[model samples]
Target: MKKTLLISHNREKLLNALVYFSKSTRFCGKTKLFKLLYFLDFIHFRETGRSITGLNYYAWDKGPVPQDLFHELKQPDTDLKETIALLEQSEDEDYRLCRVIAKKPFDPKYFSRREKKIMEELSFVFKDALAKDMVEITHLSGTPWDKTMKEKGPGKRIDYSLAVDGSKGSLSLEEIKERMSEIKEVTEIFGDQ
Candidate 1:
């Protein structure tokens, strides 16, 4: 498979997000971190037609994972080593437990207002959820992860469009109609202007 560079990737933006989620008490772990980033980028892309980090996610058994981002975090000389090192890890009966040890404030410069807003909201919603809980949430019906896993049988690229359809990743007829109506209203108001 051909590797694609995240043309718009901003390393600072990703680290900033890690910093943000690291502050959350509800969720912690490498898996959760990956899921949080995936949600931030994909959900932002769905709403604005642009990704915040421009990272591509693949359907992994754990959930949607940013492969490049993971590798970047694992680099010996990574600037984030100090922060990443603070992550606490322990062996659980079922899965490994991971948590941030040294949480720091995220730099707002790396994120847009919309992106930050979404991140904050997601952080709050999943704050109390566990890593395994996050994995289940990512695998919920209509998600890009689920769609790709079902169609391509895992390890396949999950298109970002799936995030635009809503959390379930599928739009009901009523929701579609509402969107169409909203669009018509926008066009009607802006068309004459």
Candidate 2:
């Protein structure tokens, strides 16, 4: 599928987010990391009409997943090469678990105030939650992932607009359309990077 997001996936900011979550929370595994980014992007989009990461999430069995980033992290020589590393830790080892390690310092300059605030909140709230805990949260009924899985089937792209009108959404239908139009205009002008 084509990367239709107008704003390119900001790798620098993503790396920083990873670092921030790694330092601020204990459950920074591949699964939990994806959920955090999902909330960050979807919540931000629900409020502002744009996603922070410029990523399209898919309805994977675990929940909404940024599949591109997922694949890259599972292999070597991706964008995050030196910026971060995933350290395997036994789940039962309470004292020695750290799934992700930041090789670079966190960069706050790449994030906006709202974005930073949301990340901080997510880190704090999910600090002790297990990866499966996040999975359950994202899989709750009426969520974009849940809705998509039921309506569009698995592997389908979860639309950002759903965050605006799904069960947790607060915006009206017309407002959502307007914001989506504006976003489309900006992306059309900028095109895909």
**Strongest candidate by lDDT:** 2
TM-score of each: 0.74, 0.84
Per-residue lDDT of candidate 2, residues 35-101 (tens digit): 9999999988887777887778999999999988877776644447677888888856564443888
Candidate 1 lDDT (Cα, 0 to 1): 0.72
lDDT of 1 at 34: 85
**Candidate 1: misplaced stretches above 4 Å?**
1-9, 86-88, 102-104, 166-193
Clashes of each: 1, 0
In model 2, the clashing pairs are none
C-alpha positional error of residue 99 in candidate 2 after TM-score superposition, expressed in Å: 1.1
- Which 10-residue window in model 2 sums to the lowest lDDT? 1-10
Clashes of 2: 0
